[model samples]
Target chain A: MTAVVPPAPPARLCPSLAAVYRAQLSRARGARIPLLFVATFQSIGIMVLMRGVVDGGDGDEARAVVAGSAVLVVAFVALNLLAQYFGQLRATGGLDHYATLPVPAAAVALGTAAAYASFTVPGVVVTAVCGALLYQLPMGGLWVLLAVVPLAGAALAGLGAALGLLAPRPELATLCGQLGMSAALLLGVLPEARLPEPVRWLRDLLPSTYGVDALATALEPGPDWGSVAADLAVCAGVGVAALALATWAYRRAALR
Target chain B: MASSIARPWPGLAAPEHTPDGTASAPAAFTVRGLTKTYPARRLKRSRTAAEPAAPASDRITLDVARGEIFGLLGPNGAGKTTLVKQLTGLLRPDSGAITLLGHDLVRHPRRAARLLAYLGQESTALDELTVALAAETTARLRGLDAGAARRERDAVIEELGLGPIASRPLKRLSGGERRLACVAAALTGSRPVLVLDEPTAGMDPVARRAVWAAVDRRRALDGTTVVLVTHNVIEAETVLDRVAVLDAGRVIACDTPDGLKALVGTEVRLDLVWRGEPPLAVREIAALRHLAAVAGRRWTLRLPPDRARAVVAAVTQGPAFAALDDFTLATPSLEDVYLALGGRGEGLVRS
Candidate 1:
């Protein structure tokens, strides 16, 4: 037998968040492309359908239609798909892989959420631009999406992650993800004025509604930048709270 | 119950004991009074439990010497997995002390990865990752820098002969290939201890041999301590330095393989296949009266080695030979030790 030469043990406590993020990003890219396309096309298709009923491109109705569709892309990939991802990981005993690692529970959850949220970017941008052109809305104010995409994506992705981790079964997680996206669609995409009084109260509770509202106000002529900032501020606050909730959910599930 | 457990193990030492002249040596791992119970859940009205749920892991204790390759062998629901899970810090024991390398694991479960790496029995987390990436990622997760991670990944790929499918995702590989990749991935880092559950579960004979070769080399060169959970008794006999036979969440016996088999003591195993239902006259043979039914149309028995020839002759050439289909005569194995310990074939789990 050869003399023993043990491999040196690791000195660091856990893997860096960036390292985990990069790895998760690469792992998800191939599987999520088709779904990313579905999100983009679904938003564009919805916008096209609404174009027939709403005539004036400069009206509030058109702005609501365009902005709501754009944010819907974020809901699909970040909210729906991220839920499915984590739920499936839980069901397949995949959590064992992470639980055994020295990595913190936060790194695993946030890193995965960030990767799934990143997939929504291209889809969100395309829908926003296509909606702008289809509605003949002013393109100058469309830049608010820089703020809208991340805030909305963060908010939805966090909720998706929490739902997946908290759900007792993978099927229940999928159902929750679907239900959340449907709420985003009906409550976020519809004009607030058109909703029932009680339903509008629910619209206020959803984080994505603030994103839709911010984008809608920005698409108008001489828009009130104050309202957009307030909406976005609420979004940023909700994002922090939601992400914190997600981190808690990850710890609970990992321990279980 | 035809059990030899009453005879006691010939030689079983605690982890604190040294085999050499030294009297006191630190153990690599130690477990004392480990127990975990599952809570009874609400069931359908038609299926109420007749009794409270049994503890998944009953009070158990063992010690693993430094650099030892220990094996846990048993039938289904033997608590092997639950025990391993607690050791890896994946499952929390209800109460016990799990000491690994001087750290109190029960109180500081997160520190488990400090000295141990665990490979679970089933997982799909790495299915999306390529073979090289799986190893590279695990290395990175263990706190290796990107450059060192790559070097470690490359070394493992070469060691495991995974160059052909280095870029292939685990899901794209065959069952054996996927299992091999998972092993390579889980064992990539320099952790001192490894907890492998059924490491060669889906492997072919050649792949199985390759896996053991790698594990054996690690033990020989790195002096790594390994705790393996497996049902493959043949592999356990050849590779494990020590074996623990568990039944119903408890260790019935623990000793060196040779020491445990010695308890069988000169007994020869006889496996017989039936030509048809034996004549009543043939069935009355004293040896056939105590047959342990193995499976459909086959039975096995153990007797004194000297009597094996007479029993063989009676079943193969005498008037009873007309009723016998086939027979195999062999020496006792570690599995015989398990059965001789009163194991009644998958009777542990309260299904």
Candidate 2:
């Protein structure tokens, strides 16, 4: 009898990173409702504290406080990043399932990064509203700054992906997240002119520095377009590099 | 006297066939000198801690035919999973080529993945996702539209008998149900080739039978090719068109179940029950050329398929051993074929 040969399989149209991000957004919004509530409350609390402290200060001093508060919001962004990474990894075993699919590993990483960015939407809105009302910050070019928010988030999400890939486990990822937020707070949130040269140089490497600087530029009375441009460049550059590294790391791990 | 003879079943011998009647099946999957080596770091005794790593897999080669349920049977850490991982595109081979469904698996993984579906030993589904959702997600990931994915998921859930628990979260299901979910997810896209790693490992008998029945149905209905990595011989024998027994990262025996069993030939054990003592001249009676060996009260006689009645006639004619209580003629089973092929320890049985 003649042998029966099986036919080839059809080509696959992979689900985009946007889809993965949407799924992650839905999951995070579902599981961490309490966390989101606390972060919103904390954003309001920080705005109130800034309002109380800025009453007797000069305009420049109030500007610094508003900028520093924007930097402090990095802590919330960092927490969201950690939560998204851990949540995805906990669902699928360390991105291996996504890696094995017909889609590119870069797409999976990008999709996950997009999802991470999506999770920070609530924090960005709350922080923006709080900063406007309590700090009396100038709101010109606020729409441009709002557009930059998701871009900054994308950069941070890429960084989180790199950390998730490099760290041995989820707990280590949490520790790294803590260290990252503390460093960002020290460098970006605090008045940079008051900090030492080495600390400033260290802060220069952080994506949060660009995020805080961009928000400050947009909210300043004159709306510094040059500073916004520079921050956007830095954020996009760091995001691309982190995403490449994360894709490389994920490929190595999955193909092992 | 029975021990004096070596060649039994001489009557059933047939002339070997020429090559014209025996056409070899073409290989659907071919692995040529495949090797996957993982690094093993060795610690140094010097004050400066330093070590070098080594590779894990040596060169291995295998071929599987179309429509064959090839079993890659091996114990834990025998590199079966590693080999399967390489085939499924989950891991890249260090060297060598693997062609599946007319495409090189490594060079054109997407093409290969289109034809192949892998059900890993560990379930690959989000715990919080419902069974239907998980299956639908897999179908969607495989490029099925939402409507098609829903229809396919429903069909698979029904096939797996998981309709009752389709809406429950996977973590809430029992272990068997979870495994069935993985199976349903693997079968979601209706890929022609399936690579299942211990698919029935933790299943009950009913579940196992159900899975086998499904496999049989798939093979008969769609001519789907299957590669089953299992140590469960009895279950595997039920549906396996052929078996490939793997040991130490190499295939030891590859053949049809009956073909392998035929290697042991036919041996009949005659249990005699005389008034008191067993026959004395029974040894002389067994000394006929048809007998292979006689041990204690039991006599193991090999009878050619055609002369089996003659041997029975000779044994029954004996006045010295007229009262033969019970006699059983036995042929080698798949398990016997496995053991005889040098599968030892706990290797032949599933855990």
Candidate 3:
């Protein structure tokens, strides 16, 4: 007689998350390579262009420019690409697959976000290092990116996922993603001192701004560790809230 | 095992779900009073009725036995897919109770996911993965260990004859091949219930046989319960142990194929394929035109068995035989049952 082992119960959150992460990582590795390259080069190109207008390594404008450009790489992949990814996923009925699985909704959303975020590591690191050299900023505190990349990636990926899942149509989701990346560029890449009060207030609302602020604070010869921690904490909070919203959006889309 | 529900409809045996209900044993699934309506939406804002959209599933109730193949046969827009989705816990009903394998599915959709393996009608999921990987991942996702997952994946791939395309991405496969890959994935884990919505939609006859054979193997070996949603009346007649025919979002008839067919009485249908237009016999035309439905080169006529024999002999042995390419006199089919039950054949294509 053939042995018929019954199916086990639905996987718990951790194992499900790990399985989803591995699958997404393997699937996206090849597809996202060229895009990650573009993201990295785009950040470098912006930093070089800003180098013409804003002249030196030791100034506050230089710090903002380098930091903002570095975090912009994270925004490109985690927010823009991830948004398009989820939008296409929802449009193509991909969410139905996850909804049918025994995995938790959080696992599906978080695993995808983590996979897209993973692509940004090389881009963010390379951009930070190259921007430091081009803008003549101190590279001493560049270690701050170890914290900044994930925090910002999480916050932005969650927002991207939410936009894709909540949008009624895939084209609208793509538009939302582009608008989001543009906001990151205008608010994050520009020096805070040069912005109008209202626009600066808008800058405070963008999740990547906290990442840029934390990185800029770390670029000083002697970094303000307390300010950096506070900024990192806010990014972490936004990341969590946004991810939760994404999970909710996923449920809404899947259940429909 | 058997199950029952309270609400009673004509043309079906009283469903037994509770103490007051009629089922005698344990059932794999019990759905009661399931109703879902899509709310009306206005893209441009107009004064429309405050009424909701037509109900997609209107008070569907059924009990699927533990190991039998139960088919959901319907015309398009008959709410078959909606009912299937509700049964699989992918869509929630506005009001009703669904109990699958002793779990309250409406209350716990995640548990439903664990207990059921579903192959949707049209899926682009797992399009990034190769056929082998899609099957393997599904096994793993269903909580199989690595060894078992791999074993099941290999078994399903070979069973489906997908070895040639196993390495290719689902996105790169033909529509039928992609659907086959999805079937392979859905069959990996030995879940108690399998919900297949048009599993053989894009498949050729050979592939359709493979898909059904794989499902039959699961049913025989593992005693799996299958809830199939299909518009293929022929397949439904040949394979379904029991079937529910739906029209306009309601179950028009539910019974064993024979039981439903019995509703059509002793009538038989004669189908004729003509090499050219039907013969221009005025007498034959006057006698049969009102009862027969003629569409170009094909003609269908329903009558008593004795009259069917006479008509068959008349068509085959006479001058009319010269115009006939083929002819079949068959007993009432599930489609005939639907027709007898007041279905207009709007969405149920008779293959």
Clashing pairs in 1: none
Stretches of candidate 1 off by over 4 Å are A1-15, B1-25, B44-50, B279-294, B346-351
Best by DockQ: 1
| Candidate 1's DockQ | 0.40
Model 2 quality (TM-score): 0.73
Q: Which residue ranges in model 3 land beyond 4 Å of their true spot?
A: A1-8, A219-226, B1-25, B42-44, B48-52, B273-281, B312-329, B349-351
Candidate 1 TM-score versus the reference? 0.91
Candidate 1 Cα lDDT to native: 0.80
Better of 1 and 3 by lDDT: 3
- Of the candidates numbered 2 and 3, which has the greater TM-score value? 3
Candidate 2 Cα deviation (angstroms), residue B227: 1.1
The TM-scores of all predictions, comma-separated, are 0.91, 0.73, 0.88
* lDDT per residue (tens digit) for residues A1-256 in model 2: 2232343333243454444544455556345467656655665565567577565223654555555455445345543454346444733464545545555667666766666566566666666656675667666656655656666766666676677666766677767776776666556545667778988888788777787777767776777688788888887787778678777766665544
Better of 1 and 2 by lDDT: 1
The weakest ten consecutive residues by lDDT in model 2 chain A span A1-10
| Candidates, ranked, lDDT | 3, 1, 2
Q: Which segments of candidate 2 are over 4 A away from where they belong?
A: A1-15, A29-96, A127-145, A167-175, B1-23, B44-59, B106-110, B204-210, B258-340, B344-351
In model 3, what lDDT does residue B301 have?
87
iRMS values in order, in angstroms?
Answer: 7.5, 9.5, 8.6
Cα deviation of B187, candidate 3, in Å = 2.4
Error of 2 at B175 (Å): 2.7
- Top of the candidates by lDDT: 3
